[model samples]
Target: MSLSARLEHHLQASGLPFEILTHRYAATALENALMAHVPGDHLAKSVLIHKEDGPMLAVLPANHQLDLSRLQSMIHHPIGLAPESELEDLFDDCSPGAAPPVGAAYDLDTIVDNSLSGLDKVWFEAGDHRTLIEMKGRDFDKLMQDAEHGSICVH
Candidate 1:
């Protein structure tokens, strides 16, 4: 199944209202925001981190950069970026660089940057290079309820 398909299933099962925005293929989260004509700050990007114990997802706005020091402090362990090969194997249903920020879809722990807390709406990859999933901020919060929230990024 493709990323969009899996997302659709998950959203439908959860009964959340959302819209799927399609755009030209993009290889990066910032490019996806540009192609979708959404504010970069409202586009959430997922960065997979490999810790000694396992993997976790770090989600932040497309315009922000992950604050590794802050994350390391919060996680209390050193974390490194997961290689593309690892992502490919872990997110087999999605494109190489298009995994959704909602890590629950792939059964991984998730941590979201507090910077995204107040956006009225948020956009993120739909598991492919050409699709975006848009949802209300409340819905985003609900979707990520199980994920930890912290100051994990720097503007």
Candidate 2:
């Protein structure tokens, strides 16, 4: 599969300039960075989490680890990682391990790590293992306008 139809629609409808980047297939964010020759810190990784309300997406740098405690405190409730099965059910249009960081495309709330704010550009999986979507970091923030921002991770 290529980029998810919903993601394409969201990006196009948002009118934020973006580019589709093709690279060797990769199963993890770090592998995607290596294959695409981009800095790990510039690659946004999507981690799915569940809260009492519903599912949420945590977008962070590929080189960083999600700090569960920090995220929980910021959200003021317990949250835990969503399993691969849940990911499959939620992102059926995409391959395993390859969901775009733009959670709004899937009607889910997103949380962006403040660490990503310093990045000049951002790259993330485009719903498949062999492609990424690239855009200016400011544009990314625009795409994530509804997302909450906090120090949700540590490198």
Candidate 3:
């Protein structure tokens, strides 16, 4: 089985019910809308930010942008986008455009949007452009226990 298949298998084995969506390479926001078949606001976007010490994963709504200041205060650090060159070395499973919320692959901490707590389910990349995973937001939060919940939105 391929890496993508393995990922899906792992999620299944973990008892996380999810739906996989395939697309012809759309932007993260666009991809989420396409997958949910709804407005962009209905989708959650996971943004991977790297700090001086390590990486921090930030999950936000597709319709909103990340508020770095709020994130910094919450995580207690100045976070920024991982350098293009550093991304591949640190996150081997991360493709050019697909950065999943799973931080185990990179040994980084994760922070999810507080708004996600209200949603029954959410969508995120499945390590590739052609695949997206949709699962219960609460289940995802439980799975990612180490992830901190905060305001990742730009307001």
Best by lDDT: 2
Each prediction's TM-score against the native? 0.95, 0.97, 0.81
User: In model 2, which range of ten residues has the least summed lDDT?
Assistant: 111-120
Estimate, for each residue in 78-108, the C-alpha lDDT of model 3 and write its tens digit: 7788776665565465566566666644456
lDDT, candidate 1, at 8: 71
Shift of residue 119 alpha carbon in model 3, Å: 0.8
**Candidate 3 global TM-score:** 0.81
Cα error of candidate 3 at position 143, Å: 2.4
Instruction: Evaluate model 1: give its TM-score.
Output: 0.95
- Write the number of the candidate with greater TM-score, choosing between 2 and 3: 2
Candidate with the larger TM-score of 1 and 2 = 2
TM-score, prediction 2: 0.97
Candidate 3 residue 68 C-alpha distance from true site, Å = 0.6
* Residue 136 lDDT, candidate 2, scale 0-100: 94
Best by TM-score: 2
